[model samples]
Target: MSSRPWTILGVSTFAQTAASASMSGAPFLIPALHHQGLTVAQASLLVAAPVAGVMLTLVAWGWFADHVGERVALMAGLSLTVLADVGAAFAHSHLLLGICWLIAGASAAAVPSASGRVVVGWFPPHRRGLAMGIRQMAQPAGLAVASATLPAVAAAYDLRTALLIPAAFAAAALVAVAIWVVDPPRGERTAHVATNPYRGDLFLTRVHVVSVLLVIPQFVVWTFSLVWLVDGRGWAPAAAGLAVSIANLLGAFGRIAAGQLSDAVASRMRPIRWIAYAAAATMTILGLIAGGPIWVAVAVMFIASVLTVADNGLAFTAVAERAGPWWSGRALGVQNTSQFLASAIVAPLGGLAITHLGFGWTFGLAAIPALAAIALVPVRDERPLS
Candidate 1:
């Protein structure tokens, strides 16, 4: 109800954006990796490194957040990210760079694992949807930052120099959070406070599964859009990067719109279900038109970016609200772990598929998972936030 929660949300969003830049932003370096003689599939593996690391460590970070506090978790994670980024910036070998990225990803997991809890703890249910929606903007906003800067920097300088961008973001965020972020107050511990939200129902599990399915298309779009534009359409790398950056910026707003819709409808699952349907339809349409006019394909790609990411805040709010305050951190960890697990696989497989099947068919195939997610949304299982 006060400006304080909004301030916390702002800092938390920036922190997560820093982490997202380290995690998802790595893909922007794919062109540089290709010029270094790595194949598309191989370059995608490097892009996958951070996501795989995030998948491995999210639950541990979540547990740390639950036991410690969001501010502590964020500061620790961002600090480690800065260190890992420095290692990545100086690493000469591909293997060493991948390892550094993995470490950065693992460390950056704290932002998402803890930040969602910060929003939920601070905002009431009626406004939590919008607040979390704004919080969810961090991902696409991070991608936008990466898309706009990393490719240009990599093309102008060396890959090592470009790698410092995320490190700078993390360092700046570390300072902001250290100065501004305050952990939301908690109620006194009771038996109910410690109870596991996953015990009695399949709700959390279903949400996780749906989220994983949705992540395939989301990652596919972000990971491949730049390459698709440059290599497939014969656009300049800088031009492609600019387009991707604009798309991601628009996608960030889509998250806010989805969040506001959830608040209006008072149901997180419903909007997610609709988003799944929209994603499936968009992917199918994009595939069908992939060989069509360039303008049309780009337009559809932009739309796909918006629809694919719209459900994140809705699902995120659902998970934390369902899990309750005590367990929300770990619950969010599980939620992100599932999505990142799918994301980790999406790159190499997507690259391989793009190589063999072409971007159109591979993108069309992404709709299958989005369609699957629709049925698994668990619309009836949602409960009012405590």
Candidate 2:
């Protein structure tokens, strides 16, 4: 079966948007819970539970996509996500909600792994940077939905009903995957290698290091950016949420733009060298954002988000390119595993850093990872580091 790149792109955008709504749901839900008398700390746990669940299953889903096709995994994941949303809607206890969220987290993870595999499979090498970026945009686009609707829904109606949007969206994606998703012909791929790859050892391979290090900053921003806005800049939840939403919207564009730019580079490093540099420069600017006015800080956050997330596709292309067709799934699996493991640790650590150090340090520390990813880039062709 031959799949259109655009069709796979559509699947990615839709599925990611739906799953991303869940990512945005936590911060949005916190406000609704605050109105219900829950403390900010307590409210965040509701979201965190599911995220932890997602971290646990990320690698598993990657392996699954490597073995099965991206289409099958996406269909199953989205269907399960719909069901999990139903459970989340009904769970009265925080414990049950945590469990439901965990289930949702694991299921939601499938979209990233599956969506990415589809893009890498459908597009050619020259087109992959842009294509993967387009695919990565689904994240911020999805966040935009959460930002725009989640607060209003939880406010006007109950939190239960507010979640229905993601549920319905997931259901639609299930059908879309069933009907629309297909693998491209082998002839369409840029370079054909093995048709099967192993999952266990993809991590120690040189190229996978970029995937590991890139997530350090990604998790940092994702976990703490809202906290910084509210605590550091004194922005309200509505304002903070909206700012984050806007940042995500712009961030989506950044992914596509950065992807295209990365592809344009002639270096064997492709995006790694460039992305590493951009991430450091941008995050450094963001750390300095604390002294600026709120609106400016907001803009900085948006821009930083763009830089932070830009590496999403470029790194994936490296994996697919280096690993060959058979290894893409395992490669992606390792990528997801490392990124989310960092995410799981970083998310809570972000919260802790705010309580201990000041807000500036929260963003400032991310530079460490940005530099690390850059350093990981091989300086010479076929050198050891890459």
Candidate 3:
């Protein structure tokens, strides 16, 4: 075996991390937005804009990766993300800011499906779990960076200046991807022979639904943790941000561990089901303690954050593997689209829930989706990869 796959994995991880920084990093700005006089729901709407953009364009980018190539898609997408982020930095009004971030997220949508295909294409079945696990680390790693820096910067300087962080990362990633990303070779196919993986079964659909269900709890924790710490528990913004950042780091490690477990068991769906159970239990525990002592709430929130996210890499790998090369890009795109579609809605609704119901009730309600996801995990549909 060659070291090329490892190198490619590094580039893919960086590209996705940059994109994630630009996309998933918006919620970190909610605290800053609050300081600017926006209400909770309004601030959440701004945070949801990028995710809505991501939901809108993921499939098209997947199609592009399948038809053109991963390298072109990566370079083109990252470049546009950099430009959009730059535009967002100078936006004067909330509408303009939302639009610019929407554009950034739309462009950055290229990273997930394309980079995912790159990993699936390069790594063989035996090593794919670990590889995808490392690759999946990008989201939380990006979030960790955002958590540690964005709130602090916005507090110190201005929101506009803090907005530049994602752009800088995307620009750096563009350079790396242009220099290092070579699209993996594809198998030759006859015009009439390519088959659609979705036509014959409900496996991919079930996985997508399960992912959608699971994302609600994940986003509930991720989008609200800092605010919950500050607004609900009376912590300082910087300390809350630090705590959230540490939680994200633990979540990242949790994903890697979940991936390794999948490799060991030779089943992605199994671990996902188990994680769903853990996520349900954690969310319930957090809800029970949401109004309790500050220390207990913070600790439970951290654990909920970690458990809620552990299923992402496993579900992603299963979708790509089952979809095969001919359909993996589109399938993975669907997977991301379903999750982000839920994510886009969760912010505003969750904010409203927290507003009327308080953190305790809202968090208690978040457990419902996680509980639902446990039953839809599609464990029996799994087949061993080569």
Which candidate should be chosen as best, given TM-score against the real structure?
1
* lDDT, candidate 3, 1-386, per-residue tens: 79999999999999998999998999988989998999988999899988999999999999898888899999999999999999999999999999999999999999999999999899988888889998998898889889888998999899999999999999999999999888887789654335787877899999999999999999999999988888888888789889999999888888889988999999999999999899988898898999898888889988998899999999999999888777787899999999999999999999999999998888888889989988888888788777
RMSD of each: 0.8, 3.8, 1.1
lDDT for predicted candidate 1 compared with the true structure: 0.93
Task: Indicate the worst ten consecutive residues by lDDT in candidate 3.
Answer: 189-198
lDDT of 1 by residue, 177-259 (tens): 99999988988878987899999899999999999999899988999999999888988878999999999999999999999
Give the clash count for model 1.
0
Residue 65's lDDT in candidate 1: 93
| Cα-based lDDT for every prediction | 0.93, 0.72, 0.91
Q: Which wins on TM-score, candidate 1 or candidate 3?
A: 1
Where does model 3 exceed 4 Å of error? 191-193
Query: What lDDT score goes with residue 308 in model 1?
Result: 93
Kindly report which residue stretches of model 1 are placed more than 4 angstroms away from their true locations once superposed. Answer: none
Pick the lDDT winner.
1
Candidate 2's TM-score:
0.87
* Ten residues in sequence with the least summed lDDT for candidate 1: 377-386
